[model samples]
Target chain A: MRRQNLALVMTTVAAHGPLSRAAIAGRTGLTRAAVSSLVEELNTAGLLTELGSLPSGRAGRPGRALALSERGPAGLGLEVGVGHLGACVVDLRGEVRGWLRVAADNRNRPADEVLAELATVSRRAVTEAEGTGLRPVAAVLAVPGLVGEAPGTVATAPNLGWRDVAASGLCAQGLPLEVENEANLGALAELWHGTGTSDFIHVSAAEGIGAALVVGGRLFRGARGFAGELGHVPLCPDGPVCACGARGCLEQYAGEEAVLRQAGLAAGEDAVRRLASRAREGDRCALAALERAGEALGTALAGAVNLVDPEAVVLGGAYAELGDWLLPGMRRELTARALRRWPPKALLVSGLGRRGPLLGAGMAAIRRIIEDPAELTVSRSRR
Target chain B: MRRQNLALVMTTVAAHGPLSRAAIAGRTGLTRAAVSSLVEELNTAGLLTELGSLPSGRAGRPGRALALSERGPAGLGLEVGVGHLGACVVDLRGEVRGWLRVAADNRNRPADEVLAELATVSRRAVTEAEGTGLRPVAAVLAVPGLVGEAPGTVATAPNLGWRDVAASGLCAQGLPLEVENEANLGALAELWHGTGTSDFIHVSAAEGIGAALVVGGRLFRGARGFAGELGHVPLCPDGPVCACGARGCLEQYAGEEAVLRQAGLAAGEDAVRRLASRAREGDRCALAALERAGEALGTALAGAVNLVDPEAVVLGGAYAELGDWLLPGMRRELTARALRRWPPKALLVSGLGRRGPLLGAGMAAIRRIIEDPAELTVSRSRR
Candidate 1:
């Protein structure tokens, strides 16, 4: 019972905090005395701090405000993308304290080698956070593949030539670790930081297209954790075959490689950037290729919308960089094909871009501490 | 608190009865005395009955078993199909007491005229149920289109030429009425009475194809209650124009009319039955047409499965009658196109066939009384 009350207080403050004890009690339906007791424990653990007093509304002495502490246990986030590696730290306030990114060709490389490099990057990020008085408590790593139900196991990352690899124990050595799918993390980021809708589809792209569904404020993983494989939804039943042995999947038209190939550009680390620039400069081939890709994306999304009926569709990852060129064709197809009256405001471009997965990883770790502060508090008392 | 306990006892008995009072207390985490009190009230209200005593394993006397009363208030179900109108009464134990079906060409007919005829049928069903010692308390009408968020207004039924029609007040006089979409009700019936999987997709077809998603035992109504218009999902994006003004929708290839046309048969009330008999007799044209329709249905379902990842797909309504002819092409396309490994057991045919919608409607109304017997008890006490 105490643990549940503690969580209620902590989450209330995290969501609508910098509040007085009376305000916290009012919002959470707890008595003022109970709020004060929880606040004291949180303050002692460095999970909360007192701020300036609020002006009295009731002609009495003013009450001091309380907020989530900035110097508390923080989260360390790491990412293993196909083309890059990243690490960062986020505080309870959902603010990044340190960030690092490095270009690397991780595809098909030995898993140990890539994780070893990530550990080094994570150590640097932890040290950077420590310099600011933030204690790094836990870590989460996001990867572009299917994650097993068991924590820290990557069932299959086809692009990385990995199958059934254990990932958590090798990185962020001292902290407890969890692994998550990059697309799921990206959708969580959109829910917690971007559009803030409890129900939406987050579509992202890098080496291949991926999507994650958010339903009622939680990720909607299917029965086997294989929902949201939007990339493989057939666009044409008899068109050219795909690597997954499907014919004319949406990925064959809208994935990063597909767009570049259609634009007659060589595949490289900077190819998407070049294509974006070319389209911006009124190059006919680049413009046409992006428009067609957008149409194909819309066609697939129309099917998704007809089936799932999410409140919004967010364009994230590489797609965010090409939103202006993509939205027109997408809107046209959705308007014409979607069974529901397509709302113009339902399509949104993610502001987090390539940073969403790493940031979401950090936020996810921090969220655990906020939800169950008793774990940290119990350990602290033991120490 | 008393009302809640009463409902808990009723639903517990409905699900796992005929159980003893000791068993109810064990399953509900309530004291035996509390269970006895709730059961007394339920029995007094004619909502539960004491059955034969269970065989005792202990040294003490055996306890009488409890079950939902068959003589209590019942539900009236009504359906407005393009080619038929139906009415039935179901008792608290989910047994149908009375049923009536009449062929009616309701297409583009005046709403009042069709509803007036339906009221006559519902009256007969209610009278028949009452003769069997059951009182019909509520009714639910199932329609083949979008129902508004408001209780009884239908937003649209394109085939019925209905838009913004207030339906609840028009039919089943003197009984409280509710409105629901036929596809949604079919999925609910599958959950409560058929496959019983908490997560699956129910696909039904008549004039047009419809699909409903069940997530965690509840209907996943999208942002606008328009989530399952599978007929409009593009099958061949550029093949043929549809009445919905979209090109190559699934309806153009797999709907009842479409299959009849492909088989060189005339469109009429008995068209689907004729097609089925022909396919059974090894007629090439009917067999070929059914195969093609199955492929189109599979193509659309593969996209749905890729996006939602349901545990199973149930073929319902008219499609269930033709399952033997449809399963082959469906399995082939799903194996070829769906990203996840396809399991043959995931495809099922509804044994309820065309009766799912009406049964589901009656079950829904009965569920409301089962969930909250307080309303009935309180009214009875007043009398």
Candidate 2:
């Protein structure tokens, strides 16, 4: 119970910036004495630092404000896309300290080679922050496929050409690690920090459309921990064949590959972003491609509303930059096709976008540490 | 707390035949003393009656079995369809005591007139049970549309042509009454009394594909209480127009009207049953119509799996009797189109079938009484 309270206190502080002892007490509904005791213990553990004293409001002495200290530990977040891996070093308080990105297709590279490259980049990031006295407390990797119900293995990653890979084991060589789907992690980031805090669907529309469901402030991974495979549901009986050995999938029609192929782009994130920008600038070819993508997305989103009936739909990943041009058509389908009584609300572009996976990975590590404090020591390692 | 225990004990006894006190204790995880005390209190309340001595397992004194008293107050369940309403008087243990059906269209009849007809039928059913001295303790109405988030109003009933109609109030009339969607009630009945419980989508293939989402032993009504509006979602954008002003809804393609129009059957439950019988007898036209309906249903189910991803999809309502002819095509679509990593299991025909809504209404009343014991009262009026 005490540990639960401690976790809650730290999370509350993390959520709402710096706070005085009285403020924390009032917000958490904890007694002032209990708050003081917990805060004192946290300060002793190097998890919290006291800021300058606040001005006296009444005739008594001024109180000191407390905030998360950089001395506690830091988090390492990794996001593995189809052809790129991004990493970031964030403080225990969720503030990004350092970042790095490498472009390498996992499909062509061996798993061991990818891991070694990740290790090299991660080592560089650690060396870059050596003088700050910050330690990499935990690492979280966000991959792009359905992870199995059991934690260690990745069931399938069509884009990466990987199946049932021991992801956690590879990442957990000596450091504590957490692995999650990029879309699910994006959803977690949005649920805790973006518009759809209560319920929403976060779709990463890259090579394929990956989706995550956040219901009632919690990620709802269905039976077998493999829910939200939205891209694979058949939209057309005789439509084009999908890479998953299925035809007429939402991804086959609306994914980045489809958009790029249709627009004659290089099928890269930068190219996709450039197309969206050109479309925004009223380029005829780009406009037509984006409009077609939006229609397909609308049909898929209409299907989403039919099932989950969430409060809002969030679009991220490479194609989200298309923005309102994509949303209007989607909304039209939802209004025209969804249940009239409760059509889903407007779509919102993820503010975090590409950075969402990394931040979410950091959050996953923090959540792990808070949930099982015994793992905290395992996370603290000199790279 | 006492009422919860007593309700659990009574429900357990009702589900399984009359059980010994020790057996009840073993099943409920309640202490023997607490169970004994609850049993005593319930016996005093005349809800339970102590039967004669049970069979002695060994050479010890036989303990008396406790059973729900047949003389206890009864429950009233009503299923309000498009053009007809079915009423049933059931015992506290969910045993059907008497039944009645009324023919009237909510579209043509005034709201008050429909309510009056319902009241008249309810009064007659109550009188019919007078010989057994069973008086209704509560009533539940299962309407075929989206119910409101508010407790009393039916937000929209397209088939019934009622919007914001206070069906709950119409039945309450100074009595305990609860209103729910027919599909949701059907799912509940299947979950608790018919098929073994698991995640399933219970879709009523009626005038429209009214659906109920049952996950983790509870109905998941989405935000605004309109989760199962599957009928409104567009199956084909240009196939046919829906009465709800939407284009190519699943209803237009596979609903009762679609079946009736295709099979040239009268618009009634009997006609639906006759069509099912014809399909079973291998009538080419009937079989063809049902197959078409199944294909549309399969499309919707595939979409549903892509989104919510339940363990199984359960079919119920007016067209449930189509049986295997309607199932194979749907399964084919689901297997061929659903996410390969996490495809749902095969479809299951609801065991309750057409009678599910009736039983579900009773279950709703029972649920209400159990959730809020203060609502349960011993009426002074005789049956």
Candidate 3:
């Protein structure tokens, strides 16, 4: 609870401004003493630095300035996808200090092998980040699959052929770690660093479709942390048998693999890239597949928009690449079906792009330190 | 800010119970001085009563037995439906002190006429509640329509033939009031008064299907308070044209009118009651209609469950009467569609029955008292 309030104060500052102590008190509704005490604690933890003076309140007195420090309690992010692996570190100010990404076919690989490779890349990123004076306090691993309830175990990543993959085995030193679905992480990235709406839906795609809900500044993880599986939401219950055995799931139409296969290309990044190029070049078959995929995704997304009424729907991951081809159909369906409301703006492309999940992973990794100044204090003491 | 903390303290006491001042300090993380101050304030407001003593922790000293008082602030609830009008008053302890219900065909009636009749009934209930020594501090009116962002205004009620009607104009005397959709009130009732889990979807149907989401012990109002219009969520993009001009909205198949038409009966409460009675008696046509409605409802609910992943899906309103016939198909679809995990319990029936929304309305009316005891103090002063 202490950390929650402190974290709120820090995040408010990070999101809003380097406010004066009085402004912090007003914004956070903390008594001046409480704000001063928390600010002092944060300063001691190297999470904040006091700047000289800024324009003050109505009294016109000079007020002390404060800001997130650049080189303390950094967050580490790692992501595993079918065709790539990524690692990054971000400072308290949310600036990327170090980053690494690699292309690799991870599908059909043994879970242990892929995890080991991810760990090796993660350590290398850590070493690089440390050189720039950033310290990783925690880690969040993003996977293109279902991350289970248990800390770092992935229940399944169908595209990666993974099951019960305890990824934290790589960082067995009890480094606070969590495995999260990539789409959720992507949404988190958008919430933390992109367009500043607290209530919105983030849609991302890879081999399968994924959507994440950000309501009231927090990810809307459902009763089982399985809240946002937009891919499986039935658009046409009796249309076609899906991999989940339910018929007419949204994934059958818009997933990257589905789109590629429909476009008469093999499954993989190469196929996706070629499909994009062909569509851009006005090839008939490729354009048709993308167009149809857009319609299906749009129709399903319209239903989602109608139900949740988020401020906007952000396209991320591979879907970000196909926005131009998808937005027209997506907009048409949403305009017709989204409850005739002015709000929940028309579809918006994710500003964070494909690197969203990796960036979001880093943000998650450092959340504890930001939320609990005490955690940062302890981290500082240990260092 | 002051009242919010006061409300939190009062709610904490109301929820947990009779803790020592030191214990309150520990539980709320407020200083002992702050807790003592808040306790004194609540005691002055007639909201808290200290009874003798209870055994304490640590030092084993006797602690005052604190509890919510019965005769302090009360909530009055009123509801307007196509075929019914209901009102009730609940004390601080959430016990119903007085109630009144009437059956009427309110369709196409002027909003002013319906609201005036509702006010007359509300006054009667208020008089009855006063006779029982309960003062109505606030009221919540439940309408079968969309509650607009403005206080006590219904933006639309297609069934009631009302639009942009500000019903609060009737209660201009300023006993704090709000207008809410009946389905939303039902879900809140289930959360506050029934066997409780914070994350569940409460589905109820009248002329149209409505679903309300309860997450973390609070209603999820979405970006614009329109989060729970499940009736319009497209289940089949091409199945049938719906009143909203969308195709295959859940309402087209599972709404009361839809089911009655399918069951070869006139559309009304009598027909619904007869359909239930006949289905119970193994009447073939009635049974078949229920089966098809359940499947259609199930398919759409499956999509909702897949999107929200709530702990349970509760049936209320008229659906409670039809649950016996609808559960099988609903459960089957949910089981097949939900993530392959241990979550989202099978379909549940509302124990609160048709009265859930009214009860919930009462609770909402009094939420201010529970949330901010300062308001109670202010009310008492004005009196």
Candidate 4:
């Protein structure tokens, strides 16, 4: 309980730094005595330390300012997709310290091999941070499939041929680990830190179109933990067969691979970017392809709103850089299709951009550790 | 505050029978002195009466008993559909004492005509209950469309051809009034007293498919209040044109009109029931029609579960009478389409039958009055 209260205070301070003890008490609604006790405890534990005294003009006593220790535990975040991996190191205070990216051919590789490559890329990112005063106490890995809450089992990731692959093993090499679909993490990031919207939809325009929904500041995993498979929401029953054995899934139209396949371009991020840039430069064919993708995505999103009715939609992932062309059509189709009584909810590109999933993953890891302190034993002991 | 507290205590007693003063104190978490004072207040107010002492053989002092007065403020519930109106009178404790059903043709009628007919039927029901020692002090009206939260206005009711009808006026001539879409009310009824599932999806299958979602024991109105418009979720892009100017909405496949139209029967409830009876008797045409409707409905439900992740789905309204024939195919289709990771949630036929909407409306009214005391002005004034 003490640790939890201390952690809560530390996180509050980390989120809103260098706050006077009175301010921390006001923000957390804790008694001044409780705040002072927790602050002293955290300072003793090296998780928090006093910065200075605040000069209170009308107070009987001046308040001491406290801040999160720069040397406290950090978290590592990894996002693994079909043929790419992204890694980021985040401090305990939720700030990104460093990042790394690598391209790997995971098309036909075994699950363990792909995981090994991801781990290698992650290790390199952590090592590259040299003396940056940030050390990871936990790590979260984001995948592109339905992840069971049991900590690292992928229920399915069609593009990667992962069926119940044990994800805990992938990032559990002597560290705290968690895994979730990348889109869900992105949604979480946007909900908590990006736009501060409590309820919003997040779409990841990667190899496959995926979505994450944050409802009331929590992920709404469906009856199963696989709720946000936005890619598979049937768009057209007869259009094209999807890996999920459905046809006309929104992903089949708007995913990076789908867009490239439709545009007859090579299967690469640069290829997707080139087509988007060409469209931006008034290339009719490229514009048409993105326009088509945008329409499908927008229609699918409107269907989503008709169901969940979130306050906003945050776009992210590899194709996020496509920007206005995608958003305008999405906005248009949503306004046209959503229930006419309510005005269309806002549509905004993800503020976290490519870093969302990783940051979200770190947040998830920290959440898990905080929720189950026994699980934090090794991480805390490492301090 | 004392009156409100007394009312809550009396309602609790009515819900759970005569309770000892100590038991009431324990249940309401009020002090024994407070419970006694409130019980005396309610007794004086003619809302509650003292019962014989509880026979606590081992107790040092037997506690006096209290119960809700059978003659306390009662409530009226009405469900207005295109072709018929159903009404029920319930005690403040939600026990239905009398019910009435009348056939009327309201399709294409102006709002005034519909209100007049509704008034005729409601007055007749109340007149029939005059000698029963119960008079409704409040009324809840359930319409068959999107009822906007704006006071008095029903945004749309396609079946009745009534847009923005002032429902408050319809029921406010002689009593306090509240109105809601039939589907939303059905959900409230299920949430309040149905088999006690904490979280579930309620689908009202009548002229069109509507859904009401209960999560964490409360309704989840999407960003806009139009969260449960599952009827409009596109099922087929090139299928039959929907009334909403869309093609292949689930409603076009599963609505009452759709089933009757497909069976080559007139678009009437009797025709639909006849088709269902024949389907139960293994008539090929009826079975085929039901199967098609079931498949479309099931697909839309799968999408809904993938979004809201409710624990169960309760079918209510007119089409709910289709019985087991329509359920098997729906279950089969949902099982096949929903992500295999989460096992299918349970499906239930509404126990409230056609009165689901009526009871749900009553529950909603009671909840509104309880949570927002300002809505209870008339009831408090009567006290």
Off by over 4 Å in 1: A20-41, A52-64, A379-383, B1-5, B19-41, B52-64, B170-173, B379-383
Fraction of native contacts in model 3?
Answer: 0.66
Return the top candidate by TM-score: 1
Decide which is better by lDDT, 1 or 2.
Answer: 1
Candidate 3, A1-383: lDDT as tens digits = 66666787788788776888888988988988998988887887778889889888568678798888787678889999899888999888888898999888999999888888988888999999889888787888999888777888999888888888888786638567888999999999999888888888899988889889998899998887888889998888887788788888999888887888788888865666788788899988888888888888878877787677788888887778888898877877777777755332557888787889999999887775676666666445667
lDDT of each: 0.87, 0.74, 0.83, 0.73
Cα displacement (angstroms), candidate 3, residue A3, comes to 7.8
How close to the true structure is residue A41 of candidate 4, measured as C-alpha lDDT? Answer: 58
TM-score of chain B of 3: 0.93
Q: Candidate 1: what lDDT?
A: 0.87
Q: Rank by DockQ, highest first.
A: 1, 3, 2, 4
Could you tell me which residue pairs clash in candidate 2?
A137-A379
Clash-forming residue pairs, model 4: A152-A167, A309-B223
Tens-place lDDT digits, model 2, residues A1-383: 66777776787777674888888888999999998987876776567789898664666877787887775567777877877877777776666777887877776557667767777777777666555777776788888876655565677777877777766654536677767888888888777667745777888775788788888888887655667878876666567888867677778777888877787778664777778777778888777777877877777777677666888788876556777677777777777766644344557888887778777887777666544433442223222
How close to the true structure is residue A323 of candidate 4, measured as C-alpha lDDT? Answer: 65
DockQ score of the complex predicted as candidate 4: 0.49
- Can you give the lDDT of residue B328 in candidate 4? 78
List residue ranges in candidate 3 displaced over 4 A.
A1-73, A123-137, A169-176, A342-345, A372-383, B1-13, B16-73, B169-172, B342-345, B379-383
Error of 3 at B114 (Å): 1.7
| C-alpha RMSD values across all candidates | 2.4, 4.3, 4.0, 3.6
DockQ of each: 0.73, 0.49, 0.59, 0.49
Q: In candidate 1, what are the lDDT values of residues A24-140, reduced to their tens digit?
A: 999999999999998898888888899999985989889899999999789888899888889999999999999999988898999999998988888888889999999878778
